[model samples]
Target: MTNEPIIPTRKLLLVCGCLLGLTALTVVAYYVDLGVFHTPVALGIAGVKAVLILLYFMQLRYSSGMTRAVIIVGLLWLGLLLAGTMDDALTRGWLNVGAP
Candidate 1:
């Protein structure tokens, strides 16, 4: 008795196409300078790609609620770590400490 979810070929192909298109868009975004908006644009596109891959390739869409919860929690933890790192890096020069 197999418990695996069967995904349709058409849906998989569609997702593949979307991922490829997003990759191309990323390349295009890299060349065009948006100044301050560039980083946000790139990160946004990458986030979309990551979500698509997570849902489709990782089969998260077919996973149980508990499984999804775990994945969400893991992502939240990762975000927290990244936020902490960014905070430290950004605030490094705020207070001047003596160098010995």
Candidate 2:
């Protein structure tokens, strides 16, 4: 037993609780009116859930730094794509003489 660490049962249970709590909150958020930024808020909530999974359930907290960097890169790339698409859609048409 050369100091091989062990995660306690209580901490594991707490993490599980957090996951469930977030899931419930996400459902509630879906039902409520988040006003003008509803979609962005929901997307942010999903990102939070993903981070929780990566940090806890996915055990990334105990993994190497490279793995974490990869996760961050993936998320950033996704954000870039989503932002680019939204930008294109919003700016695709201006005054093109009734270009339907």
Candidate 3:
């Protein structure tokens, strides 16, 4: 049998409350204009929510070392994919091509 750590009901409720608050913040951020900071702010809040879900709901905090390593690797791979896509998009207009 595998041994797993059990979380308390109060902690779970707190996390749930935090997640709800963050969701509300995200919606509020959408209506407010921070110019170039909007996207980063939204993404930052999302990242925090993701971490909370991963650690508590998914039980990654109680998972084995290998499981955590795998999660990290997966995140790294996703980051690389996003970076590549952004690189291509941002550089697309650098060169001008004549209409054929």
Candidate 4:
């Protein structure tokens, strides 16, 4: 196994603080209505939180290029799936297939 350097306690603490702050922001976002932007705003904050956790807690920042590439590809695949699902959902109302 490679000799991996340990993450500093101060850095971990800072990340923890940031995560806590983001969590608070997410909670606040729920209470604030943003009309058509509400979902996007909440998702943006959640994405940031996911990135921070992946880079710090998961130690992906120090991971190899292959690991990063795999993760990126996987996330892209997930995004494509989500987009396809959303498209279907958004278009369902337009199908005009009424109930019997």
Task: Point to the candidate with the largest lDDT.
Answer: 3
- How well does candidate 3 match the true structure in TM-score terms? 0.84
* lDDT per residue as tens, model 1, 7-46: 8989889999999999999999999989999999999999
Quality of model 3 by C-alpha lDDT: 0.92
TM-scores vs. true structure, each candidate? 0.84, 0.71, 0.84, 0.80
The TM-score of predicted model 2 comes to 0.71
lDDT of 3 at 51: 97
* Separate clash counts for every candidate: 0, 0, 0, 0
The 0-to-1 C-alpha lDDT of every candidate, in the order given, reads 0.90, 0.79, 0.92, 0.89
Report the poorest 10 consecutive residues by lDDT, candidate 4.
Answer: 91-100
Per-residue CA lDDT of model 3 for 1-100, tens digit only, reads 5699788989999999999999999999999998999999999999999999999988888999999999999999999999998887777777754322
Off by over 4 Å in 2: 1-6, 95-100
lDDT of 2 at 6: 62
